[model samples]
Target: MRRRGPTRLGRAAALALAAVIVVTGCTAEPPPPEPQPGRLVGAPAPLDVTEVYLQQRIAAMTLREKLAALVMVHVPGTDAARIRSVLDRYGFGGVIIMGDNVGGPARTVAGLTGALSSEAGLPVLTAIDQEGGIVRRLREDDAAAARELRGLPASAAEQAFRTRAALVAEAGVLINFGIVADVTPDSSSFIRSRTLGESPSAAAERVAAAVRGELGTVLSTLKHFPGHGASPDDSHISIPRSSIGMRAWRATHAVPFRAGIEAGAPLVMMGHLQFDRISPLPASLSPTWVTILRQQLGFDGVIVTDDLLMLQRSGLPEYENPLRNAIRALAAGNDIVLFVLPADPGSVGVDLTGLLDALERAVGDGRLVEARIDASLHRVLSLRRAASGLVEPYVDCGPKCWGESPRSLALADVPPTG
Candidate 1:
């Protein structure tokens, strides 16, 4: 049996095919190059860089600093330097710019906030109550507020919040205590004018739409949780009381909060409202309400208290102490305790040193568990990280980009170094 070689024609065809293969090898698109270590071509870097960053940052904080970070204070003034000095002196994690703080336009306000935070990696949470309508701190926000949006469609609520959030962000504020998730049908109710909807269902739709509109511009907050519409009284002066049970609440007031959480709101503010049947204490100081908010409503974001100063303004003997209210709020699962202070904080019985000392004592005496404080700190710090855009997937500029090397620069401040 003899093995035969190719014919002349077959040999010529083989040679032509080989030449074609060489030509294709040179001209055709190359296979995706092997992934280079420390180089992110179109691929996303680890998403947990932000989480690691938060954990490391929190781990380095002292007990006093951690407690201070949980408090967001307000100093009434237009002087950026003075406010920043107060923040720096207290080493607070955040500040709320009030009507007095906005001395002029947005650019001027930016200077105030810009001074509040020098670290771009993790900026201090500068917040403002720019709810438009009656509650706005910035007069430049001419967007449709709850008063007008309530009459319009859900899309109108989205558009209005979009415009409002942009104004807040333009002022260099990171958090906007703008969205009023409360609902009430009473035309005489105090919060009626600032509510997005008269009915629960209507409010839910609009609240969700508003959150969607504020998705990327700034951190959106849903206020007066358990709903301010629970009572006709104003929380600023009186502790509003309601008797609505969990069943009735779920069917009515909880509708908007649930919808807002689902729509990705980053913060929920516990109001100083009391539902006696549920808890004798106000929601801001009620563990029952916090449990319900976390377990029942399924909200996992940061929970802050409405102005602690309001508790003192209630004129009640028990609620007169700001330090006590802060401890209770933190112990009850609130991540942040807010204080809106006048130039004279002593006039309202709020001494920053005394408050911090009380918190330190609470932690030492086991009145407020250190673990609970850590949990709240984690949530607050995580929110700050996300708000700063640190949690977004990282991308490498490859070898062609300018400035510092992306990998080295990103890793320089990142955590899990061990």
Candidate 2:
């Protein structure tokens, strides 16, 4: 070869350049750095009860047991034999007790509940209208009972319900169809003294407080949902209607219900009243109102009817027999039917077996869908599961509250009930 400039490359420079290129080409990229510990690192994930569990439970039930689970019947007597007979014949989801059930003592009621529970190992949803004031069956003179709750600070109201829930638990009542959420300011209103009182906002605050208090102790229910102030008539005697339009209804009547739901009330009792402007149908049988409660207000708990038997008293052509009414109630989203026998003498006494028969026929004939029944059946069972008496500390309410000679709390016992 001809002589080139400097004859060849600089040895040190060529060696350094070759070394750099070879070192870069041979090296491997380090793996992504290991993630650092997060704030929630060792905490266990929250339990997620899949819907499959609930569906499995529902699938295991028979048609009779399923339908029976959806009806909450009124048992007239405290006679353990009579009560046991009724229970033995029908597996009612619940039994409602009144003053008649409370003979001399709270133990009488406890005994009734114990007998029912013994007959069926499952916890019976023993309910009462112990709203205090004129609505208390256990303590007829409850003017002071709720006075201790009304207008008090939230903490105080919660504490009061805690004490009251203890009393209710001792009486073997898991559900208190108490905690009136209606804003009927009319002194003549049937729900007058039973209310939390003063104004809607104040009453709403108290209603929520009562719910918080009763949560772990007893299942709190918001009564007469969407307010019972629409019609002046007593729901027990005739069907009532709310005249207020949607805007005003939302503004005034729905205040307490909204608050109660926010406070986590386990159940909302739909009244027999109709809000014509909202839905032509009675609120208890109206899907519109229920959609408002479920979709808008976000109420995911149980929705119970005031009393299906009241349909006969409604005088509305659309509402027929209690059985049909019960089906409508479920279709409209009511999870439980309160089948209180009307005090009206001419009306027929409630027959739960007949009601079950009617429902089975309805389901078989396609008048009521099995899925619709399942919807309600599952809801009722779920509520019983969540708001169970398992946590309650059962004790003797003693003669003071439920004794034959229970100390009177009222100026005079007026057979407390609105």
Record all residue pairs in model 1 with backbone atoms less than 3 Å apart, i.e. clashing: none
Q: Tell me the lDDT of model 1 at 268.
A: 95
Instruction: For candidate 1, give the lDDT.
Output: 0.83
Sequence-dependent TM-score of model 2: 0.76
Best by TM-score: 1
Off by over 4 Å in 2: 1-53, 118-121, 140-156, 315-320, 342-346, 386-418
Error of 2 at 315 (Å): 4.2
RMSD of 2: 20.9
| Residues 137-246, model 2: lDDT tens digits | 88733334455556566677666677777778878788888888887768787766667756788788888888987888788999898887655678876777766798
Clashes of each: 0, 8
lDDT of 1 by residue, 242-264 (tens): 99888888999999999999999
RMSD of each: 12.6, 20.9
| TM-score, every prediction | 0.83, 0.76
lDDT of each: 0.83, 0.71
